[model samples]
Target: MVSIGALARLAGTTTRTIRHYHAVGLLPEPSRLSNGYRDYDAHDAAQLLRVRRLVELGLSLPGVTAALGSHPTPGAGVRDALLALDADLAQQAETIGARRRQLADLLAREDLTTSEQVADLLRDLTTAAPGTGPDQLRRERDLLELLETSGGAEGFTGIADRYRAVLADPAAVDRIGAWAARFEALAGVAAADPVVTEVATELRMLGPELFPGPTGSPAEDGGHGETAWAAFLASLTPAQRRCVELAGQGWPTCAP
Candidate 1:
Protein backbone atom coordinates (compact mmCIF):
# COMPACT_ATOMS: atom_id res chain seq x y z
CA MET A 1 0.00 0.00 0.00
CA VAL A 2 1.11 3.53 -0.65
CA SER A 3 -0.05 7.14 -0.34
CA ILE A 4 -1.86 8.86 -3.28
CA GLY A 5 1.33 10.76 -4.20
CA ALA A 6 3.35 7.54 -4.26
CA LEU A 7 0.76 5.78 -6.43
CA ALA A 8 0.72 8.75 -8.80
CA ARG A 9 4.53 8.59 -9.21
CA LEU A 10 4.43 4.80 -9.77
CA ALA A 11 1.68 5.21 -12.43
CA GLY A 12 3.44 8.13 -14.16
CA THR A 13 0.48 10.46 -13.52
CA THR A 14 -0.34 13.37 -11.27
CA THR A 15 -2.18 13.26 -7.92
CA ARG A 16 -4.80 15.63 -9.39
CA THR A 17 -5.39 13.27 -12.33
CA ILE A 18 -5.77 10.33 -9.93
CA ARG A 19 -8.28 12.30 -7.86
CA HIS A 20 -10.15 13.29 -11.03
CA TYR A 21 -10.25 9.68 -12.16
CA HIS A 22 -11.71 8.70 -8.78
CA ALA A 23 -14.30 11.55 -8.92
CA VAL A 24 -15.35 10.44 -12.41
CA GLY A 25 -15.66 6.85 -11.08
CA LEU A 26 -13.01 5.78 -13.66
CA LEU A 27 -10.72 4.50 -10.84
CA PRO A 28 -12.00 2.90 -7.67
CA GLU A 29 -11.19 4.90 -4.57
CA PRO A 30 -8.95 3.16 -2.07
CA SER A 31 -9.57 2.88 1.69
CA ARG A 32 -8.52 5.70 4.00
CA LEU A 33 -5.61 5.22 6.44
CA SER A 34 -5.54 5.89 10.21
CA ASN A 35 -4.37 9.42 9.40
CA GLY A 36 -7.52 10.05 7.30
CA TYR A 37 -5.55 10.14 4.02
CA ARG A 38 -6.31 7.85 1.08
CA ASP A 39 -3.88 4.89 0.78
CA TYR A 40 -3.75 3.35 -2.73
CA ASP A 41 -2.74 -0.29 -3.19
CA ALA A 42 -0.99 -1.94 -6.17
CA HIS A 43 -4.40 -2.79 -7.63
CA ASP A 44 -5.34 0.91 -7.71
CA ALA A 45 -2.07 1.81 -9.43
CA ALA A 46 -2.63 -0.91 -12.06
CA GLN A 47 -6.16 0.37 -12.65
CA LEU A 48 -4.89 3.92 -13.16
CA LEU A 49 -2.26 2.70 -15.59
CA ARG A 50 -4.92 0.83 -17.61
CA VAL A 51 -7.09 3.97 -17.70
CA ARG A 52 -4.13 6.03 -19.00
CA ARG A 53 -3.36 3.40 -21.64
CA LEU A 54 -7.00 3.39 -22.82
CA VAL A 55 -6.97 7.21 -23.10
CA GLU A 56 -3.71 7.13 -25.09
CA LEU A 57 -5.40 4.68 -27.44
CA GLY A 58 -7.90 7.49 -28.29
CA LEU A 59 -10.72 6.22 -26.06
CA SER A 60 -12.84 8.87 -24.39
CA LEU A 61 -13.43 8.71 -20.61
CA PRO A 62 -16.92 7.36 -21.28
CA GLY A 63 -15.51 4.79 -23.66
CA VAL A 64 -12.95 3.82 -21.04
CA THR A 65 -15.77 3.36 -18.57
CA ALA A 66 -17.70 1.05 -20.88
CA ALA A 67 -14.59 -0.96 -21.76
CA LEU A 68 -13.42 -1.44 -18.14
CA GLY A 69 -16.85 -1.76 -16.60
CA SER A 70 -17.22 -5.33 -17.89
CA HIS A 71 -17.68 -7.38 -14.70
CA PRO A 72 -17.15 -10.99 -15.81
CA THR A 73 -14.54 -10.25 -18.49
CA PRO A 74 -13.22 -6.97 -20.00
CA GLY A 75 -11.61 -8.58 -23.09
CA ALA A 76 -14.71 -8.68 -25.36
CA GLY A 77 -15.69 -5.08 -24.57
CA VAL A 78 -12.18 -3.75 -25.10
CA ARG A 79 -11.88 -5.65 -28.40
CA ASP A 80 -15.20 -4.26 -29.72
CA ALA A 81 -14.35 -0.70 -28.68
CA LEU A 82 -10.93 -0.90 -30.35
CA LEU A 83 -12.47 -2.29 -33.54
CA ALA A 84 -14.95 0.60 -33.66
CA LEU A 85 -12.16 3.13 -33.08
CA ASP A 86 -10.09 1.54 -35.85
CA ALA A 87 -12.97 1.92 -38.31
CA ASP A 88 -13.32 5.62 -37.38
CA LEU A 89 -9.59 6.12 -37.84
CA ALA A 90 -9.74 4.47 -41.25
CA GLN A 91 -12.53 6.81 -42.36
CA GLN A 92 -10.57 9.85 -41.12
CA ALA A 93 -7.51 8.64 -43.04
CA GLU A 94 -9.52 8.34 -46.26
CA THR A 95 -10.87 11.86 -45.83
CA ILE A 96 -7.36 13.25 -45.30
CA GLY A 97 -6.08 11.36 -48.35
CA ALA A 98 -8.78 12.85 -50.56
CA ARG A 99 -7.99 16.36 -49.33
CA ARG A 100 -4.28 15.80 -49.99
CA ARG A 101 -5.04 14.74 -53.56
CA GLN A 102 -7.08 17.88 -54.15
CA LEU A 103 -4.23 20.03 -52.79
CA ALA A 104 -1.77 18.20 -55.07
CA ASP A 105 -3.91 18.83 -58.12
CA LEU A 106 -4.22 22.53 -57.28
CA LEU A 107 -0.45 22.81 -56.79
CA ALA A 108 0.25 20.98 -60.04
CA ARG A 109 -2.00 23.30 -62.03
CA GLU A 110 -0.94 26.49 -60.22
CA ASP A 111 -4.48 27.81 -60.66
CA LEU A 112 -6.06 27.43 -57.26
CA THR A 113 -9.08 29.62 -57.92
CA THR A 114 -9.68 29.77 -61.66
CA SER A 115 -12.27 27.44 -63.07
CA GLU A 116 -11.26 24.89 -65.73
CA GLN A 117 -13.37 26.66 -68.32
CA VAL A 118 -11.69 29.99 -67.61
CA ALA A 119 -8.24 28.35 -67.80
CA ASP A 120 -9.07 26.78 -71.14
CA LEU A 121 -10.31 30.11 -72.48
CA LEU A 122 -7.02 31.79 -71.49
CA ARG A 123 -4.99 29.03 -73.13
CA ASP A 124 -7.04 29.30 -76.31
CA LEU A 125 -6.58 33.07 -76.42
CA THR A 126 -2.81 32.76 -76.12
CA THR A 127 -2.68 30.17 -78.88
CA ALA A 128 -4.87 32.27 -81.16
CA ALA A 129 -2.69 35.39 -80.82
CA PRO A 130 1.02 34.69 -80.69
CA GLY A 131 2.13 38.14 -79.55
CA THR A 132 -0.22 38.19 -76.58
CA GLY A 133 2.21 39.03 -73.75
CA PRO A 134 2.31 38.06 -70.10
CA ASP A 135 0.84 41.39 -68.96
CA GLN A 136 -2.14 41.00 -71.29
CA LEU A 137 -2.70 37.42 -70.10
CA ARG A 138 -2.57 38.52 -66.46
CA ARG A 139 -5.09 41.28 -67.19
CA GLU A 140 -7.40 38.80 -68.88
CA ARG A 141 -7.15 36.47 -65.88
CA ASP A 142 -7.85 39.36 -63.48
CA LEU A 143 -10.96 40.24 -65.48
CA LEU A 144 -12.15 36.62 -65.35
CA GLU A 145 -11.59 36.58 -61.59
CA LEU A 146 -13.51 39.84 -61.22
CA LEU A 147 -16.37 38.45 -63.25
CA GLU A 148 -16.53 35.41 -61.04
CA THR A 149 -16.39 37.56 -57.91
CA SER A 150 -19.20 39.76 -59.15
CA GLY A 151 -21.60 36.86 -59.49
CA GLY A 152 -21.20 36.75 -63.25
CA ALA A 153 -19.89 33.23 -63.66
CA GLU A 154 -22.76 32.12 -65.90
CA GLY A 155 -22.65 35.31 -67.99
CA PHE A 156 -18.87 35.12 -68.25
CA THR A 157 -19.09 31.56 -69.56
CA GLY A 158 -21.35 32.74 -72.37
CA ILE A 159 -18.90 35.54 -73.18
CA ALA A 160 -15.96 33.13 -73.12
CA ASP A 161 -17.74 30.74 -75.49
CA ARG A 162 -18.47 33.56 -77.90
CA TYR A 163 -14.87 34.80 -77.72
CA ARG A 164 -13.64 31.28 -78.43
CA ALA A 165 -15.82 31.13 -81.49
CA VAL A 166 -14.46 34.47 -82.73
CA LEU A 167 -10.87 33.28 -82.29
CA ALA A 168 -11.49 30.04 -84.19
CA ASP A 169 -11.10 31.78 -87.57
CA PRO A 170 -7.43 31.90 -88.66
CA ALA A 171 -7.93 35.09 -90.64
CA ALA A 172 -9.55 36.79 -87.70
CA VAL A 173 -6.70 35.73 -85.43
CA ASP A 174 -4.06 37.16 -87.77
CA ARG A 175 -6.05 40.35 -88.24
CA ILE A 176 -6.36 40.78 -84.45
CA GLY A 177 -2.65 40.20 -83.95
CA ALA A 178 -1.77 42.72 -86.68
CA TRP A 179 -4.19 45.28 -85.26
CA ALA A 180 -2.73 44.86 -81.74
CA ALA A 181 0.78 45.35 -83.11
CA ARG A 182 -0.28 48.49 -84.98
CA PHE A 183 -1.99 49.91 -81.89
CA GLU A 184 1.06 49.21 -79.72
CA ALA A 185 3.34 50.84 -82.33
CA LEU A 186 1.31 54.04 -82.06
CA ALA A 187 1.93 54.34 -78.30
CA GLY A 188 4.53 57.12 -78.74
CA VAL A 189 2.77 58.83 -81.65
CA ALA A 190 0.70 62.02 -81.28
CA ALA A 191 -2.98 61.48 -80.51
CA ALA A 192 -3.90 63.40 -83.72
CA ASP A 193 -1.32 61.69 -85.95
CA PRO A 194 -2.42 60.24 -89.29
CA VAL A 195 -1.38 56.76 -88.06
CA VAL A 196 -3.77 57.11 -85.07
CA THR A 197 -6.63 57.99 -87.42
CA GLU A 198 -5.74 55.11 -89.72
CA VAL A 199 -5.61 52.64 -86.81
CA ALA A 200 -8.90 53.98 -85.54
CA THR A 201 -10.50 53.42 -88.94
CA GLU A 202 -9.14 49.87 -89.06
CA LEU A 203 -10.45 49.19 -85.54
CA ARG A 204 -13.92 50.32 -86.58
CA MET A 205 -13.84 47.89 -89.46
CA LEU A 206 -12.60 44.96 -87.33
CA GLY A 207 -14.82 45.52 -84.32
CA PRO A 208 -18.04 44.07 -85.73
CA GLU A 209 -16.26 41.00 -87.06
CA LEU A 210 -14.39 40.30 -83.84
CA PHE A 211 -16.99 41.04 -81.19
CA PRO A 212 -20.69 40.26 -80.80
CA GLY A 213 -23.11 42.99 -79.74
CA PRO A 214 -23.16 43.93 -76.07
CA THR A 215 -25.64 42.30 -73.66
CA GLY A 216 -27.34 45.77 -73.29
CA SER A 217 -27.83 44.78 -69.67
CA PRO A 218 -26.18 46.60 -66.78
CA ALA A 219 -23.12 45.10 -65.15
CA GLU A 220 -23.26 43.20 -61.86
CA ASP A 221 -23.22 46.43 -59.84
CA GLY A 222 -25.73 48.07 -62.23
CA GLY A 223 -23.16 50.69 -63.43
CA HIS A 224 -19.79 49.00 -63.06
CA GLY A 225 -19.68 48.37 -66.81
CA GLU A 226 -19.30 52.07 -67.57
CA THR A 227 -16.91 52.58 -64.66
CA ALA A 228 -14.70 49.69 -65.80
CA TRP A 229 -14.66 50.97 -69.39
CA ALA A 230 -13.65 54.42 -68.18
CA ALA A 231 -10.85 52.88 -66.09
CA PHE A 232 -9.63 50.91 -69.11
CA LEU A 233 -9.49 54.03 -71.27
CA ALA A 234 -7.68 55.91 -68.53
CA SER A 235 -4.93 53.22 -68.57
CA LEU A 236 -4.18 53.56 -72.32
CA THR A 237 -1.71 55.88 -74.07
CA PRO A 238 -3.04 59.12 -75.55
CA ALA A 239 -2.73 57.77 -79.12
CA GLN A 240 -4.51 54.55 -78.20
CA ARG A 241 -7.16 56.58 -76.37
CA ARG A 242 -7.70 58.73 -79.46
CA CYS A 243 -8.00 55.67 -81.65
CA VAL A 244 -10.49 54.02 -79.29
CA GLU A 245 -12.57 57.22 -79.10
CA LEU A 246 -12.59 57.61 -82.89
CA ALA A 247 -13.50 53.96 -83.34
CA GLY A 248 -16.32 54.25 -80.82
CA GLN A 249 -17.73 57.25 -82.69
CA GLY A 250 -17.49 55.45 -86.02
CA TRP A 251 -19.04 52.23 -84.68
CA PRO A 252 -21.10 52.90 -81.58
CA THR A 253 -21.94 49.18 -81.27
CA CYS A 254 -18.19 48.42 -80.95
CA ALA A 255 -17.74 50.31 -77.66
CA PRO A 256 -17.16 48.04 -74.66
Candidate 2:
Protein backbone atom coordinates (compact mmCIF):
# COMPACT_ATOMS: atom_id res chain seq x y z
CA MET A 1 0.00 0.00 0.00
CA VAL A 2 1.08 3.57 -0.70
CA SER A 3 -0.24 7.11 -0.38
CA ILE A 4 -1.10 9.17 -3.53
CA GLY A 5 2.04 11.24 -2.87
CA ALA A 6 4.19 8.08 -2.80
CA LEU A 7 2.53 6.85 -6.05
CA ALA A 8 3.19 10.19 -7.74
CA ARG A 9 6.85 10.15 -6.65
CA LEU A 10 7.18 6.61 -7.98
CA ALA A 11 5.64 7.66 -11.31
CA GLY A 12 8.05 10.65 -11.65
CA THR A 13 5.14 13.15 -11.62
CA THR A 14 3.41 15.53 -9.26
CA THR A 15 0.46 14.86 -6.92
CA ARG A 16 -1.63 17.27 -9.00
CA THR A 17 -0.99 15.09 -12.08
CA ILE A 18 -2.36 12.05 -10.23
CA ARG A 19 -5.52 13.96 -9.26
CA HIS A 20 -5.86 15.21 -12.83
CA TYR A 21 -5.70 11.66 -14.15
CA HIS A 22 -8.38 10.65 -11.64
CA ALA A 23 -10.63 13.58 -12.69
CA VAL A 24 -10.24 12.68 -16.37
CA GLY A 25 -10.96 8.97 -15.59
CA LEU A 26 -7.57 8.11 -17.10
CA LEU A 27 -6.93 6.23 -13.85
CA PRO A 28 -9.38 4.91 -11.25
CA GLU A 29 -9.90 7.16 -8.21
CA PRO A 30 -8.13 5.87 -5.12
CA SER A 31 -10.15 4.74 -2.10
CA ARG A 32 -9.84 6.81 1.09
CA LEU A 33 -9.14 5.42 4.57
CA SER A 34 -10.90 6.48 7.83
CA ASN A 35 -8.36 9.32 8.26
CA GLY A 36 -9.44 10.79 4.83
CA TYR A 37 -6.15 10.06 3.01
CA ARG A 38 -6.29 8.39 -0.43
CA ASP A 39 -4.97 4.81 -0.37
CA TYR A 40 -3.23 3.27 -3.41
CA ASP A 41 -2.14 -0.36 -3.61
CA ALA A 42 0.68 -1.85 -5.72
CA HIS A 43 -1.85 -2.46 -8.55
CA ASP A 44 -2.80 1.26 -8.46
CA ALA A 45 0.86 2.24 -8.71
CA ALA A 46 1.33 -0.02 -11.75
CA GLN A 47 -1.75 1.44 -13.50
CA LEU A 48 -0.67 5.03 -12.75
CA LEU A 49 2.80 4.32 -14.11
CA ARG A 50 1.27 2.84 -17.27
CA VAL A 51 -0.81 5.98 -17.76
CA ARG A 52 2.26 8.18 -17.21
CA ARG A 53 4.40 6.22 -19.65
CA LEU A 54 1.67 6.26 -22.33
CA VAL A 55 1.29 10.03 -21.93
CA GLU A 56 5.06 10.45 -22.31
CA LEU A 57 4.77 8.44 -25.53
CA GLY A 58 2.33 11.18 -26.79
CA LEU A 59 -0.90 9.17 -26.38
CA SER A 60 -3.86 11.35 -25.58
CA LEU A 61 -5.63 10.62 -22.29
CA PRO A 62 -8.51 8.83 -24.05
CA GLY A 63 -6.02 6.76 -26.07
CA VAL A 64 -4.16 5.84 -22.86
CA THR A 65 -7.47 4.78 -21.30
CA ALA A 66 -8.38 2.66 -24.37
CA ALA A 67 -4.91 1.05 -24.41
CA LEU A 68 -5.09 0.35 -20.68
CA GLY A 69 -8.57 -1.20 -21.03
CA SER A 70 -7.31 -3.77 -23.54
CA HIS A 71 -6.73 -7.34 -22.26
CA PRO A 72 -3.14 -8.61 -21.84
CA THR A 73 -1.62 -5.88 -24.04
CA PRO A 74 -2.53 -2.75 -26.05
CA GLY A 75 -4.95 -3.65 -28.85
CA ALA A 76 -4.95 -2.86 -32.59
CA GLY A 77 -7.11 0.22 -31.85
CA VAL A 78 -4.26 1.77 -29.83
CA ARG A 79 -1.80 0.81 -32.58
CA ASP A 80 -3.86 2.69 -35.19
CA ALA A 81 -4.12 5.75 -32.90
CA LEU A 82 -0.34 5.76 -32.47
CA LEU A 83 0.14 5.52 -36.24
CA ALA A 84 -2.18 8.52 -36.79
CA LEU A 85 -0.25 10.54 -34.21
CA ASP A 86 3.02 9.58 -35.93
CA ALA A 87 1.71 10.82 -39.28
CA ASP A 88 0.51 14.10 -37.72
CA LEU A 89 3.93 14.64 -36.12
CA ALA A 90 5.63 13.97 -39.45
CA GLN A 91 3.52 16.68 -41.13
CA GLN A 92 4.28 19.14 -38.34
CA ALA A 93 8.03 18.45 -38.67
CA GLU A 94 7.89 19.06 -42.43
CA THR A 95 6.06 22.36 -41.91
CA ILE A 96 8.70 23.48 -39.42
CA GLY A 97 11.51 22.49 -41.80
CA ALA A 98 9.94 24.41 -44.69
CA ARG A 99 9.51 27.49 -42.49
CA ARG A 100 13.21 27.28 -41.54
CA ARG A 101 14.19 27.20 -45.24
CA GLN A 102 11.99 30.25 -45.96
CA LEU A 103 13.59 32.09 -43.03
CA ALA A 104 17.05 31.28 -44.43
CA ASP A 105 16.05 32.73 -47.82
CA LEU A 106 14.77 35.92 -46.18
CA LEU A 107 18.02 36.28 -44.24
CA ALA A 108 20.00 35.94 -47.48
CA ARG A 109 18.21 38.83 -49.18
CA GLU A 110 20.24 42.05 -49.75
CA ASP A 111 17.47 44.63 -50.09
CA LEU A 112 13.78 44.73 -48.99
CA THR A 113 12.74 48.26 -49.88
CA THR A 114 9.24 46.99 -50.61
CA SER A 115 7.41 43.71 -51.00
CA GLU A 116 7.84 41.91 -54.37
CA GLN A 117 4.35 42.78 -55.63
CA VAL A 118 4.83 46.54 -55.17
CA ALA A 119 8.49 46.66 -56.22
CA ASP A 120 7.89 45.92 -59.91
CA LEU A 121 5.23 48.63 -60.29
CA LEU A 122 7.40 51.23 -58.56
CA ARG A 123 10.39 50.29 -60.74
CA ASP A 124 8.31 50.59 -63.91
CA LEU A 125 6.98 53.98 -62.80
CA THR A 126 10.52 55.25 -62.14
CA THR A 127 11.80 54.11 -65.54
CA ALA A 128 8.80 55.26 -67.60
CA ALA A 129 8.29 58.58 -65.84
CA PRO A 130 11.85 59.87 -65.54
CA GLY A 131 10.55 63.44 -65.58
CA THR A 132 8.93 62.90 -62.14
CA GLY A 133 10.95 64.93 -59.59
CA PRO A 134 12.54 63.41 -56.50
CA ASP A 135 9.96 64.99 -54.16
CA GLN A 136 7.01 63.76 -56.21
CA LEU A 137 8.68 60.37 -56.51
CA ARG A 138 9.12 60.19 -52.75
CA ARG A 139 5.48 61.08 -52.18
CA GLU A 140 4.35 58.37 -54.60
CA ARG A 141 6.52 55.74 -52.88
CA ASP A 142 5.37 56.80 -49.41
CA LEU A 143 1.69 56.63 -50.41
CA LEU A 144 2.06 53.18 -51.96
CA GLU A 145 4.06 51.92 -48.97
CA LEU A 146 1.43 53.22 -46.58
CA LEU A 147 -1.34 51.50 -48.51
CA GLU A 148 0.62 48.27 -48.89
CA THR A 149 1.47 48.08 -45.19
CA SER A 150 -2.08 48.85 -44.09
CA GLY A 151 -4.32 45.94 -43.15
CA GLY A 152 -7.26 47.79 -44.71
CA ALA A 153 -5.52 47.93 -48.08
CA GLU A 154 -7.78 45.06 -49.18
CA GLY A 155 -10.04 47.61 -50.87
CA PHE A 156 -7.15 48.70 -53.08
CA THR A 157 -6.16 45.25 -54.29
CA GLY A 158 -6.22 45.87 -58.06
CA ILE A 159 -4.25 49.17 -57.91
CA ALA A 160 -0.90 47.66 -58.85
CA ASP A 161 -2.30 45.80 -61.86
CA ARG A 162 -4.06 48.95 -63.10
CA TYR A 163 -0.83 50.96 -62.82
CA ARG A 164 1.07 48.22 -64.62
CA ALA A 165 -1.35 48.36 -67.53
CA VAL A 166 -1.19 52.15 -67.73
CA LEU A 167 2.58 52.35 -67.48
CA ALA A 168 2.88 49.70 -70.23
CA ASP A 169 1.40 52.27 -72.65
CA PRO A 170 3.98 54.99 -73.47
CA ALA A 171 1.33 57.69 -74.12
CA ALA A 172 -0.50 56.85 -70.90
CA VAL A 173 2.70 57.05 -68.89
CA ASP A 174 3.52 60.41 -70.52
CA ARG A 175 0.04 61.73 -69.67
CA ILE A 176 0.39 60.51 -66.07
CA GLY A 177 3.81 62.10 -65.66
CA ALA A 178 2.40 65.40 -66.96
CA TRP A 179 -0.59 65.03 -64.62
CA ALA A 180 1.62 64.49 -61.57
CA ALA A 181 3.95 67.33 -62.51
CA ARG A 182 0.99 69.69 -62.81
CA PHE A 183 -0.39 68.47 -59.47
CA GLU A 184 2.96 69.25 -57.83
CA ALA A 185 2.79 72.76 -59.33
CA LEU A 186 -0.10 73.66 -56.99
CA ALA A 187 1.97 73.88 -53.80
CA GLY A 188 1.22 77.46 -52.61
CA VAL A 189 -2.03 78.02 -54.53
CA ALA A 190 -5.37 78.38 -52.73
CA ALA A 191 -7.88 75.52 -52.57
CA ALA A 192 -10.45 77.43 -54.68
CA ASP A 193 -8.06 78.00 -57.62
CA PRO A 194 -9.38 77.08 -61.09
CA VAL A 195 -6.41 74.79 -61.84
CA VAL A 196 -7.46 72.69 -58.87
CA THR A 197 -10.64 71.79 -60.76
CA GLU A 198 -8.66 71.46 -64.01
CA VAL A 199 -6.22 68.99 -62.44
CA ALA A 200 -9.14 67.12 -60.92
CA THR A 201 -10.80 67.04 -64.35
CA GLU A 202 -7.62 65.75 -65.97
CA LEU A 203 -7.54 62.90 -63.43
CA ARG A 204 -11.19 62.04 -64.19
CA MET A 205 -10.52 61.95 -67.93
CA LEU A 206 -7.51 59.69 -67.39
CA GLY A 207 -9.60 57.12 -65.46
CA PRO A 208 -10.86 55.31 -68.60
CA GLU A 209 -7.32 54.86 -69.88
CA LEU A 210 -6.29 52.88 -66.76
CA PHE A 211 -9.46 51.02 -65.71
CA PRO A 212 -11.97 50.59 -68.55
CA GLY A 213 -14.63 49.13 -66.31
CA PRO A 214 -18.11 50.55 -66.34
CA THR A 215 -18.60 53.64 -64.18
CA GLY A 216 -20.74 53.33 -61.13
CA SER A 217 -21.83 55.49 -58.22
CA PRO A 218 -19.19 56.02 -55.50
CA ALA A 219 -19.42 53.13 -53.06
CA GLU A 220 -18.29 53.23 -49.46
CA ASP A 221 -15.43 50.91 -48.45
CA GLY A 222 -16.62 50.60 -44.84
CA GLY A 223 -14.21 53.34 -43.68
CA HIS A 224 -10.98 51.35 -44.21
CA GLY A 225 -9.92 53.10 -47.43
CA GLU A 226 -11.23 56.36 -46.01
CA THR A 227 -8.73 56.22 -43.15
CA ALA A 228 -5.83 55.62 -45.55
CA TRP A 229 -7.03 58.42 -47.83
CA ALA A 230 -7.22 60.87 -44.95
CA ALA A 231 -3.66 60.01 -43.91
CA PHE A 232 -2.48 60.43 -47.54
CA LEU A 233 -4.19 63.82 -47.87
CA ALA A 234 -2.38 65.12 -44.78
CA SER A 235 0.92 65.38 -46.73
CA LEU A 236 -0.48 67.55 -49.53
CA THR A 237 -0.73 71.35 -49.91
CA PRO A 238 -4.20 72.98 -49.89
CA ALA A 239 -4.68 73.14 -53.67
CA GLN A 240 -3.21 69.70 -54.26
CA ARG A 241 -5.25 68.25 -51.40
CA ARG A 242 -8.46 69.92 -52.64
CA CYS A 243 -7.79 68.70 -56.14
CA VAL A 244 -7.47 65.16 -54.88
CA GLU A 245 -10.58 65.51 -52.73
CA LEU A 246 -12.50 66.79 -55.72
CA ALA A 247 -11.20 64.01 -57.89
CA GLY A 248 -12.03 61.56 -55.12
CA GLN A 249 -15.69 62.68 -54.84
CA GLY A 250 -16.25 62.12 -58.56
CA TRP A 251 -13.65 59.70 -59.95
CA PRO A 252 -14.65 56.73 -57.75
CA THR A 253 -12.78 55.03 -60.61
CA CYS A 254 -9.37 56.81 -60.57
CA ALA A 255 -6.36 56.75 -58.27
CA PRO A 256 -2.77 57.14 -59.40
lDDT of 2 at 86: 90
Clashing pairs in 1: none
Model 2: CA > 4 A from native: 32-34, 57-73, 110-115, 123-178, 181-196, 208-256
Work out candidate 2's RMSD over C-alphas.
6.2
Clashes per candidate (backbone, < 3 Å)? 0, 0
Which digits, one per residue and each the tens of the lDDT, describe model 2 over residues 1-256? 5888888889999999999998988889878899999999988998888788778989888888777676455566667767878998999999999978766665655425555555666777888887779888778776666656543345345666676778889998888888888988999689998989999888777774342221222254444444555677888998988887677664544333
TM-score, one value per model: 0.50, 0.57
Please report how far candidate 1 places residue 245 from its true position, in Å: 26
Query: Over all chains combined, what TM-score does candidate 1 have?
Result: 0.50
lDDT of 2 at 84: 79
lDDT of 1 by residue, 33-68 (tens): 888999877788788888898889899998998988
lDDT of 1 at 231: 55
- The superposed Cα distance between candidate 1 and the true structure at residue 172, in angstroms, equals 9.4
